[model samples]
Target: MRYVFFNHQGRAVLGVRTADGVKVLGEETLESLLERGVDLVTYGANAQGPSVEIGEQDYLPLMRKPGKIICVGLNYADHTKESPYAQPDYPTLFPRFNSSLTAHNKPLVRPKVSDTLDYEGEMAVILKSGGRHIPKDQALEHVAGYALFNEGSVRDYQFKSPQWTVGKNFDDTGAFGPDLVTADELPAGGKGLLLETRVNGKIVQSANTQDMLFDVATVISTLSEAVTLQAGDVIVSGTPAGVGFGMNPKVYLKPGDVVEVSIEGIGKLVNPVIDEA
Candidate 1:
């Protein structure tokens, strides 16, 4: 089942996509529901509540307060080639705070500090439970759902130091939802799906999930060996080549630009770019 968080009557509520419309689960957030072990599929099927036409409500990040937002860089071979760093045997991981997350249709702020705001379209995996040292073979079992992400970056800040945290975690830079498709709704480890990014309706990046150098399972398993993965923690499976930074002449987002990231089976996450106030 597809799940989302949206604003209903001025309050944030969890919702499940229904044949009629979006069924309001409750005022509880997605993270709360998962933490309580609520059976989303069952609740969505049997619970009776108000429903709203999808386009009429305000969208929220799929999980408003994910415990952690772990991102993998250079997970796609082509992206690694385009980047300045040499390809490594291990996954290149980083963290994004919740402060950076904005919902679908929201504005991605291009900070005044730099005009190098760029887009990296990606697929993100949300964990259903917590574990440590999880075996790579069994990693798929830990995924709760999948969603799309626009890893909007402030390029100038990113390369100022070896650490990418500053550029990647700028408030309102990352766009992360529309809805979450349960693991069962997609292929194992979300493999074989087409992922693409478009700017102002023009395709800029295109690739398949199969092209990822470190697939979903490997990322989860590898991270688990060091940090304990928790329920509602999000893993942003890195983007493919053709990012604005990788393009010839180097295209970057400007005010009034619309960026859309779409993945097969999952849905599109569209956001507009605006100058930071």
Candidate 2:
């Protein structure tokens, strides 16, 4: 089942995609529903509501205030080779603040502080349930659905220090969702799906889910070993090579450029660029 969490006419509402159109599931945010222990898989598929045609939803983040946004940096091998860091055996992980998230159809701001704005398109896994040290084999069952993410970065600030949080946490840089496609609608653990990133109508990065060194299950299992993964947590899987800074000529995002992140089963997340005022 596919679900869209959006703002319609100024009020937040949840909708489930149906044959008739988008069915108004309820006004409750996905975050609240999950915190209340609603089984999204069963609830989203079975819940019925009045059919509504939402032409252009003012999209919201998959989770308005996701408890944690754990991000993996070098899951894609090629991306690592293109970077200055040497490939490591373990996943290169980081944290993103909730304030950094933006929604689909929103404009990603190119900060006035730097012109080196870069885009890293990736898939974000939303968790329904989790616990400490959850086994890798059982990790996939904890997933609720999947969404797209544009892991936008400020290149100069990113390399300012060995740590990445400063550059990665610039507000409104992470373009998140148009919809959250439930797990039952796709291959298990989101495997074998095509993930592509485009800038200004040009294909800049392309790869497959199968290319990820650390898949969903592994990342979840690995993360669970450290902290408890809650119902509303988000894990942003890393992107492939071909980022602006990695290019020889270095093509960074500028004002008026449109960026898109498309995944095979999930959907495409599109955002326009704007200069910070």
Candidate 3:
């Protein structure tokens, strides 16, 4: 079932799409939905309060408190080519703390520290349960779902030094969601899925997930070997080319610019750029 976290009244609430409208699950989001009960049908009756239509308002990030937001870098060949970085034989990983996550339709703060902001369209995987050293064959069992993301980056902060932590963890740099499609529900694992980034309605970058150098399964299994991925952990499967930094004359985001990241079956995540408060 497609699940989304939206503002109900003034608070974030989890919702399950229904034939009638949306079944307002509760104030708690998807994480709580899994802990309370997977069968939303059981609570559908008590959830009878008028449901808010998602498109009518802004959405919060898919998960409010994912334990970790692990990111894979240069998984796409074109991305490596654009930046002219070495192709990785294995996934190049980094940590994007949970505090950096913002929801779909939210305003992303382009901090004053950097003017060279770039957008990386990507697919993010949310972990369903805990497991360390998980085999490739069984990795799918650990995935809870998938969401689209614009892995916003500050090039100066990221490339000024080898370590990417500082540039990658800027507040609200990672914006994703609309909903998380359960792993089993997505089409052909790691196959080409269209991904695109548009700035103010103009297409900037577009590519297919099939262009990925390292597939989804490989990323999950590789990471699992070292870390016990728990429920609510999110893994961003890198992004495609067409980034601002890759353009002829770097085109970074400025205030009032709108960025949209789209993945074939997962849906689109749109966020507007805003100056830091």
Go through the candidates in order and give the clash count of each: 0, 0, 1
Worst 10 residues of 2 by lDDT: 54-63
Q: What is the TM-score of each candidate against the true structure?
A: 0.97, 0.97, 0.92
lDDT of 3 by residue, 1-277 (tens): 6678887767777877767777677786666655443543344435665655776455888888877889999888888989858887988999998788888889788998889878888998877675788888887766777888788998889997888888888898889797787665676453677888899999888888888887777888888889987777888999888899898888899999999998888888899999998
List the candidate 3 regions with Cα displacement exceeding 4 Å.
34-50
Stretches of model 1 off by over 4 angstroms after superposition: none
Instruction: For model 2, name the residue pairs that clash.
Output: none
Predictions in order: lDDT: 0.90, 0.89, 0.81
What RMSD does each model have against the real structure? 1.1, 1.1, 2.3
TM-score ranking, best first: 1, 2, 3
Per residue, candidate 1 scores C-alpha lDDT tens digits across 112-230 of: 89999999999999888869999989999888889999999999899999999999999999998888888888999999999999999999999999999999999999999999998
Worst 10 residues of 3 by lDDT: 36-45
Candidate 1 vs 2: which has more TM-score: 1
Candidate 2 lDDT tens digits, 1-277: 8888777767778988888888888788888877788887788778778887775547787678888999999899999988999888898889999899898888899998999999999999989888999999999999988999999999999899999988998988998888888888899999999999999989999999999999999999999999988997999999999999999988899999999999998889999999999
